[model samples]
Target: MATLAHLSDLHLGSSASAARTLEEAVAALADTELIVVTGDLTENGRTAELAAFDRITAPLADRLVVVPGNHDRCGDDVGAQLMRGVRVDVQVRGGCSIVRIDSTAPHNRVPWLSHGRMCQQVLEQVDVALGAVPDSVMTVVALHHHVVPLPAEGFWEQVSEVLHLPNHSELALGTELLKVLRSRCDLVLHGHRHVPRQFIVDGDSARPLRVFNAGSTTELGAFRTFDFAGGRLLGDPRWHQVTPEPRPSPQVWQAPVCALQLA
Candidate 1:
């Protein structure tokens, strides 16, 4: 089976204590074939913050894939240029297709579907990336901001002014992009909201797509491990929390969640 390590919302500058969490998470991910970070790598998208990320993930450089969140574009430094958006389509071990899409822009800080033109272009880019992958392959699309609302409806509504479309047409456009990807993929992965979620889309009838939201590793104490084989996705994800040791503790602390299934 092929294993992928997924985490998001590291939010490095949120606190100095956050480093221990990063170290623990990275240690857990060292063995996976691919490591996917959904977004918000930094608390404010500062150069030093991003640099810290580069250093932290240095050992896994060749296998890591990352995208930007609203926070990554809001601060002083130009992160887009630093990361070059890190958008690309690649094949994972066991022949699964992995597409990393960049949905946020450097100048656009607020989280919204207001950048319709850019969103359309990125969607088209995703389509092209999928087309290049063989039909027999299992596919996983990764991004920063979530395309669909999560269980935390009340919280999302507050940011809907910048995130969701006020009208159905705009909403349709945002969804259509995902629908197109669903046609050729087995799963979708994203993170922006700090809460963990799993959304299964059965609207296609003929093809079912599972969207796994890895949530925020630094903030919510959540992360996932996926198993795949050949070109098919197999088994449910194993989620766990990485607890931080007290300042005086001599060694790092780790926690395991026995009941990790998500509907």
Candidate 2:
């Protein structure tokens, strides 16, 4: 069985850098066929910060698939440069096929900005990508925002509540997106809540549907590993946590680290 790693919301160059945890995650998941980063690579999408992220993840070069979060596009041309690793939707031979979409609006800091909007253009793209998945291959889709509210419990709930001025999730659009993917995909991976969640979303069809929120890998030290065989998920995902070491250097990233290579 082949293994896959799921991580999200590193938020680098912000309050704390989880360089150590990231390193550990790479080491721990070294054997996985692919490492899918859902979004929020940098705290503010600074060129330097993205470069640092590239350096930290370069060892996994060919095995990485990344997507953008609201923060990743904050800098100039970051979206174009960073979108390569953010490969959206594919057919993984002998493994699973994945479809990823950009769920972040250019402006998300506004009171009404946090909500995820799934417009017609985006839906059509998803429809085309997911519609072609071969039945033998497991299908997975990814996005930066949550399709469901998935409120956390207790103290975490309080923090999540305050973080949102007005909770505008991908309610309607997510539903439309799901309609296209429900039968096409088995797992839908995403992260924006910064809190890990594993649950089943029941659509009209009875086929098993799963959703995962990887949370902030750099912040909460949370991640997951999935085993697959014959292009199907084997069983329940294994969750992991790590204690990160402090950043070795206090320097920050403000300049472009590499040339733009988004294809």
Best by TM-score: 2
Ten-residue region with minimum lDDT total, candidate 2? 253-262
For candidate 2, give the lDDT of residue 6.
Answer: 86
Among residues 3 or more apart in sequence or in different chains, the pairs in candidate 2 whose N, CA or C atoms overlap within 3 Å are: 66-85, 66-86, 89-99
Off by over 4 Å in 2: 84-94, 109-112, 152-168, 202-207, 244-263
lDDT of 2 by residue, 1-263 (tens): 88788899887777544676777777777677878898888777688878878998988888887777767767653544655543345645336687878776557533234545567887887777766777778778878888766564356445656875344444457766666666567788888777576666453344457777787887666577788887667877876655543222112111112211111
Candidate 2 Cα RMSD after full superposition onto the native fold (Å): 9.5
Off by over 4 Å in 1: 82-95, 110-118, 151-172, 203-207, 244-263
lDDT of 1 by residue, 1-263 (tens): 77887888888988975666887777777777878887788887788888889898888887887777667776664447544645454645435667877666644454342231235666777788888888777788877666653333344455664554541112224466666766588777877665566666664355567776676777655467888877767767776566653332212112222222123
Clashes of each: 2, 3
Error of 1 at 20 (Å): 1.4
Provide the lDDT at 93 for model 1.
Answer: 42
Candidate 1, poorest ten consecutive residues by summed lDDT: 250-259
Q: Model 2 Cα displacement at 66 (Å)?
A: 0.6
